[model samples]
Target: MTDYNAPLRDMRFVLHDVFQGPALWARLPALAERVDADTADAILEEAAKITGQLIAPLSRNGDEQGVRFEAGQISTPDGFRESWHTYREGGWVGLGGNPDYDGMGMPKMLGVLFEEMMYAADSSFSLYSALSAGSCLAIDAHASEALKAAYLPKLYSGQWAGTMCLTEPHAGTDLGLIRTRAEPQADGSYQISGSKIFITGGEQDLTENIVHLVLAKLPDAPAGAKGISLFLVPKFLPEADGSLGARNGAHCGSIEHKMGIKASATCVMNFDAATGFLVGEPNKGLAAMFTMMNYERLSIGIQGIGCAEASYQNAARYANERLQSRAASGAQAQQRIADPIIAHGDVRRMLLTMRSLTEGGRAFATYVGQQLDLARYAEDAGEREHAQRLVALLTPVAKAFFTDNGLESCVLGQQVFGGHGYIREWGQEQLVRDVRIAQIYEGTNGIQALDLLGRKVVADGGQGLAAFAAEIRAFAVDAPVHREALLEALVRLENTTRWLLAGVASDANLISATAVEYLHLFGLTAYAYMWARMAAVAQAKLAEDAEFCGAKLACAAFFFERILPRGLALEASVRAGSSSLYGMEAGQF
Candidate 1:
């Protein structure tokens, strides 16, 4: 297995050269004083060094050791606790955290790359830190000042960690069906009683305390998701002096033995009348939970990219080293009995597909990150609102598309390795196992599609999609290359979106049955738009760095010529409607 390396060059190309991230950051007053191009570059270099050097080495052993649950206490694999201490002390847990609490105050554009590298290096380790960052986001946005002061510093510093407790044995996607109860007490806290399953980083040896952001119902609350409230429940309650005090009622019942990310503990937590504090307003916890959903969802999406990149690196390295039959075009290396597999057309195709999709996904992720920055830090309200709309429109795509393509990319990388890919020690199989969850978790790829097509697009009469299409068109107008191909895909997206929005009201199950195809169609178009923008930038800078810009242009061509055409099939599937999907009765063979 090849060691994982952060794609710092492409990351820099996307951040500075293509998207003008520094320019965007400079305009946002919140980021202006905090970050610059050099600072951002330095962060990237340090992150690359840390992830590649520190975390990447632990992946194989961590997977083998997994997490140990002994007498209700869950311990991480060897080296994890020490790594976590180092990571936390470095302030990485609060890389994009609120500056008010000593966070580095970096923007999402930078965070996305860091996350990609972390996940790529070691997904299991990344989850512990990812959940902490996500929990901090929710608390910073919705929690009270006191709660923030008490928890934010420790969490940001990595002294403490956080987890989101929403799923139960019976409730997965349907939060409305959750039975967890939150009863108010005279002391201005609540008593939380619930059992949450599939809680990532719920109970680990990495941190001093674990802050669980749990969802439950108030005593007087109405039924369903609307009545659900978010509570801040701690494993170890802190005293007034900010030191660890009494143990809370929350306990780790056990952890799951999973197919992938074995090193990360997936716990079944029991909150036996645990003392809890409300995060946001009463009966509005669902709303509050979603405030951080965007961030979490995006981070999860990057997991796919990271794993794909890791797999691709190994596959690419193997393809060059593994000797095989001479290329169909004849011997390229006269010294060897057979040429490297890389000389084969099919192998080249697979490698290029992985590269194109991974690179395009990176660009799209950065674009979404840029919008996140705009949504939070833009001086103009209109810009902020528009950025939010774009975020709502694209977050699902970022999650589902990146992951779906991530799996595809990983599979392709595996295929390039032939039989060796299946071997456990090679790490290709591990990448496949680890990335598989990204499609299943963070609200599943299917749920993300429904949210994208049903809520973000159809519910708004496709205004969000329309605005996105317009932006693509606007970019294509000045694009240096592949303008026509981008427009063609955009038109297809617009038409498919029209069909979906128009039919969703009449056919209630339209979104459910066809949303995946709709999302793919949208994803293809989105990547095409990304390629067009990137191609334009690469074209202009061809003179400065011919080799780098040339590679960018080649990848863009591969995306447009070799990959983007998949949109046609997806559009057709969406237009086919849900009739065939629902035609069979439940009992039918």
Candidate 2:
């Protein structure tokens, strides 16, 4: 079984120590009254219990059983419906949704923590709920007040689930090419006709109704993305009493059987003149859809972190308990027959790398979450702008780096198990498979890099980079200890930022080609800064309690000494530019 205890401890450290999140939460009037340290801790404790006891046990089963499609219906793995029932009954679906619409109104910072736990427990099961929550966020942000009052409550209560329908047969990342049409009807509604592929939770047996926020073009609309519009298409029409009424024209033509996250029910949806309501303004669908897409990007990153946490726990347990070759130091004569693999330096190295990345990733996520919260709730205009810039700059990094590291960490965790890692029984391989999608979906890591380098870095005149560099500078200057190491990382980041700005204008391809490496370098440097800050906090806490704080400080040192050095390689790779990546011929593959 995967151990969630350590992960939860790390979460608390990130929340209380690294972020002092509760203190910030106290500043926002709406969130202040509802969430305090005690309440937040209680929520986290309950979340951990639900995740470990309920969700983790079902992970492998969900992956194995997958989703089944018969006729026009979709059925998830056995026990998933029951688990989802418990999940919704607990009001988890609305954990961070809008309070005005009957959601729990938890802060995104808190939601990030629970999301990490959810993903760690079972990413397959977590994805369905994530889609609903993400869709709710988008709707809450952009949908009309009537729509919010009508649909948000049901989505929050789990009476219904929500999905963002953007991908079509022809359009994945390029929404300008979408063929879906939404024509205005006499009743002031629209009739939607189109096919959407890879529509997760498009149609499922889990909820009473499915609410799809779709993107389509109006018949008279101009060509390309500017002509697009967003529409709300429900699986079933609503009755006067707000209950599900007649079935709509939308149906799941089929469900996809894929490499991982099988229980998610990726669907190919067919909307045949589906009755729909326009969301936001006409010809602004892409902007509206991005409200949800951005959140999903972060959620997917959490998925990666969750898988890495799971893999690390499983691998660590195996290493400690599974006796193998003798210690290299010849220190344990009593167990001379065989020593645990953990006694080997390489195994320890892998485990530490996993720990550093996982813990650091969570901290960075919370940091981003704090910025998101501030962007909405902060009283000062400058504060909000600062927060927004941070969100914009770090969002891509959080989405790409965390997910990529999640896969890397999980794969490394699997390798620590040797051949047993590849086998099905151990569940290590499942984690590797589950985390792979994070890198591919929610905008490929490559695209995320391009956005970071092109839009976030250069287009904004390096404002985002400047803000992030400022944050790093503040941390290095103010942090009680480990200041030098943090400063070192910041210095490296500053130099890289200058290089990116200088190169982007002269040779745009240079930025595009080297974007991924620069993003990684930036991510690793940022993570290193976070780890150093966390280590400083952990070190101070050690004076109060030795054992608890000691382990944390050790993990911090492990991150700086062993993991932070990877930034050097990332920096080197970025300096290499796109020459190697783009120069190859099409037939080279």
Looking at candidate 1, the ten consecutive residues that score lowest on lDDT are 496-505
Give lDDT for model 1.
0.92
Candidate 1 has a TM-score of 0.99
| Reference-based lDDT, each prediction | 0.92, 0.87
TM-scores, each model vs. reference = 0.99, 0.97
Residues 458-566, model 2: lDDT tens digits? 7887778877787778767778766787778778877877887787767758877788988898898888878877888888888886887898788888888878788
Best-fitting candidate, scored by lDDT? 1
Tens digits of per-residue lDDT for model 1, 432-477: 9899999998799999999998889888898898888888888878
Output the lDDT of residue 415, model 1.
88
